[model samples]
Target: MKKFRFALALALTAFVPQGFAQDVQPIDGIAAIVDEDVILQSELDRAVRNITTQYGDRADQLPPVPVLRRQVLERLILVQLQTARAKSTGVRVGEEEIDAALAAIARQNNLTPDQLRQQLAADGLSFSEFRASLSDELAIQRLRQRFAQSSIVVSDGEVDAALANQASGTQYQLANILVALPNGATPEQIATAQDKIDGIKALLDRGEMDFQAAAVRYSDGPNALEGGDLGWRSADEIPSAFTNVVGGMQAGQVIGPVRGPSGFQLLQLRDMRDAAGSGASQNVTQYQASHILVRGDDAAAKARIDALRARVGAGEDFAAVARDGSDDTVTSGQGGDLGWFVHEAFGPQFGDQVSALQDGEVSAPFRSQAGWHIVQRTGTRQTDVGAENRRNQMREMIGQRKLEDEWNRFLREMRSEAYIDIRPAAGVAGVTDGS
Candidate 1:
């Protein structure tokens, strides 16, 4: 069905049968380029129009047109830059990878791949052009992954630096919806739809309905059947329309029945916390720990943990104790050292438990559905200060700084770099209807 929809959309919009080139108005223009990749004015206009026309009405903090333009240009430049680097490094995003990404995008937007394609065309984007967009995104991901491997290590000193510059902060765990009215819907029709949704929300607010059940029944989202679960997204990950609601919300709270492009949306807050309230120091060395099976006998597991505790109490080397009596095979052979890890790499359940233990404090037996188990605090280091856990923040800043310092130096030394060309006829508008 998805494929058929896309094929149908393709047929109607940009398809040229029998291998003839799909026509685009040949506007002689090049907005920017990076080695083999180019960003055209057409792409720029499409992006802007998509943002302003499709998402703008639903936004409370819409960026001014000029600000939006500059951001779009910088991003386009970065895409080209990544393509140049990726090509040089012989990196490519395979078709399977592209298909997987496309599928994920469709799932996110509540459509099948073909349906998404048709929607894009309806909004004036060609499928071929959209494919190019996906290509650029994949290339950038590959390049960033490579760069991150060599450049993203956050040592204790680095974590300290991050903490020193850190200030108080907060964050939210939230999910949302953006409702866009159909092109031909009358004003009265739109209002009626919004009112209907709002009436349902009023019931939810007054405790007359279950949130997830209501969302599942009424939400027009891809995750609707799964109860509108967006899965632990950060405040920054939320669309600006509901940022304020998310940023300030407490756990189990909900907000909205708010105005949107197509109709009304209600945001639900799954959880929230003060970001800096926990005084736990981040400048701590992290060690990886893994445990293996000794399952199906709680009494026996407790006995083993008791014995291990006595051994360590008698001043035996902790690592030696692990090797001698522990069944956590991943660490037992290696003296219980899992590897170097940043604390948060462990999810909340494990992270909270480990964070509370001082170095060398063996944990009490805890029961998870998996089994009865013991956790040991092998070692600690001073690391992961403040927002260092914000994955992209450090590397992006480092990459930009590196470019500023060394790009010109490298350029001066490249004797065989190609000469750039500028043509008089290559100036024009992008591919949009003044979006």
Candidate 2:
């Protein structure tokens, strides 16, 4: 997926010269209106061009231009609806947050922010446009998270079934390309999709194209932009249709053109691993630690932390120093005791520093997102592998599956409820049934 992002950058770069050659103004109008929000024809045209560029040589394999335009317009409507909904619910993202996300994307491409801007310009994309798109993406994400938390529920039976499957111990890192067949499609459509997938498989067999590239070009799955990456999953987590087939495949091997409810799917086994005890286990190290936090203006905070570290190093009791100097009111009176915690409980910065310490070792002052801190590791113990942890993991897995389903349904319902009016030039008047 990281590689795919870089590919996206390169693909956009190719559009620069052509974009510059074209007239600055072309006819543009409304594509669709979602409640108070509107999708612009210009935006739809750009999206179609992007999809074409991403697909490269395989662009011809896509649906008819009119069908593709409608599909893109529908997606835009969904996005506008979600963004509108987010604002109504008071979901907000700060400019700082968007900048941070852009910085991360730059870092992924090994470029500085300025360099990333230059790259975007070279790709014919204005920084402001890119930032606006990213902000909308983040807003949609926040909206989905809010909905998922309230709507998703996992049953005990689901957890038990998940655990039973986990007991098989095998897990796979898989990538897939799907050629989707619409519901109640005629035999001709099915045969055409099959033929398309067969051609894809033949290309894979001949090593004409890599899996990631092919997925970006041809996959109909939601993760197509991420090269159809499904991440790592245990057998039970996989869709039932591909479970047995993937179990029998080897790493770096491609399988399928397998028929399933949604469509014909081609899968590649990227890698695999085994969980402990022929089943899932959650045995992990837990830390008991304490910290002294100091917050002031930057220089003052640094000075105070330095002084506190010196005092503790000079044989002052850590608990005494923490009680006297720490800023965390809840833990300061308790001598900064954080109680027992798993590594993830405190996030990477705190967890990593604590993990590096031996029992009774005090760490050098470090800064986290919160502020400066000097931590003392008092003890460590391994958590027991048990049914409780397994059940918790199972619940999370089940919840994620339910979340995806519900989110899709939610989008469909939103589209159905919206008063959408697609203009004639947009070329998609009657095709979108909230699918």
Candidate 3:
């Protein structure tokens, strides 16, 4: 069967179609040009409208129209650059992938595919247009994945050092506003950026404007429109230059105008959480479970799993029954003994089923991507995974930090090399030339 959902972090509201709604009357003019690609005025207008719709009651908190337009246009430009580069590098997303993503979106919003289409129609968006936009998003994601695989490498020594750094397992939820300076910025440009960042800091310090509001109005970062919310970061995940400074900050505290690869940034520590409590050991619960798998692609498979479930429910020896009926040749030969493994050893469905049962209790038949399964929980134990888990987490953290730095640099280089021209009619209000 086709996969029912995508693994992409696509939220219904957040996945607003990049294309215009069907009812947006066309304005016959080029808003901007990037290489051979041209952005139309109508597309810009629609993007602006979409952001306005997203903000709703908080729309009043948004920057003025001209500023918002410039922000949206820059985003569009980046998207175009990314998609074009992805295609040039042979990245492709098929129609089946787009269909699966659409189905996933529909399921997430509690709507059938037809209902989703109807809702899109009511909102003046065509289903086909939405599919195209989703395709671009998926392609760009795949491109990024490929880039991370090829460009970002975390060494074992780095992970070891991260583990050795005597720090507690604390994580911070952060937000930041960046006053960006161009690559190879002159003294005048640096002075101007410094002034802007200082002014923003002054506004935030006096509480004249909140961090989020100030971010929306003035930040030049990619997430400016989202109020510069960077989510959570562990000590290892933070940029090396700012780690010590951030570690010293308390919740609701703000710091910066600190210079980094991207620019001078104002950082805010919104909240913090202890990943593992102080002096607490990391332990994972493991389930000793066994399952009977009835593999097939049709109702016959479901019927077989149900019958096997009935046999076990009627007090037949589960191991004997599994040996006779289970299609998982590897485990079936061993009386279906799966051995002890962590909760996430198998997929979520298997873990949940096992976790829900008491020792020696069997679960109702369920389907997974593998096939239909009926699991029996044999026992459970808590195992300390502190050392192993910390090493793994540190490896991932180092990789993440590297990827962010590499990707930002890649984007800056791409933007600098691209041939871009913004028309006067595109409304460059409040935005400077060559900005």
Q: Which lDDT value does model 2 have at 307?
A: 97
lDDT against the true structure, per candidate, is: 0.54, 0.76, 0.83
**Per-residue lDDT of candidate 1, residues 1-435 (tens digit):** 122122211121111111112234454576554345555666555545544543435433333455445445534444445566677898887888778777777886778988877776665556775666566567756665666566445455554554454443454555544343444568886887777677767878788767775664455543343456766544344544675556556677778777654346777887765655434544665765543223445687767667766666787776787677666666678776666666666555666666677666766655554454556666666665644544345344444444422432332223114222222222432222111
Model 2, span 127-196: residue lDDT tens = 6766776676677778887897789878888888777755466678989898877656799999999999
Highest TM-score against the true fold, candidate: 3
Give the candidate number with the greatest lDDT: 3
TM-scores for candidates 1 onward, in order: 0.36, 0.70, 0.77
lDDT-based ranking: 3, 2, 1
Q: Report the C-alpha lDDT of model 3 over 1-435, residue by residue, as the tens digit.
A: 011234574222322444435475757788888889888877777778878877889987789889988888888888889989999999999988888888887897788999878887776776677788788888888888998999988888888777788488788998899988889999999999999999999999888999999999899888898888888988888877779888889899998879999989999999999876533567889889888999985999999999999999999988998999999999998778899998778878788888999998999999988899998989999988877776777788898899888888888889889988888767756554342
Query: What range of 10 consecutive residues in model 2 has the weakest lDDT sum?
Result: 9-18
Worst 10 residues of 3 by lDDT: 9-18
Clashes per candidate, residues 3 or more apart or on different chains = 12, 0, 0
Error of model 1, residue 411, in angstroms: 12
Worst 10 residues of 1 by lDDT: 9-18
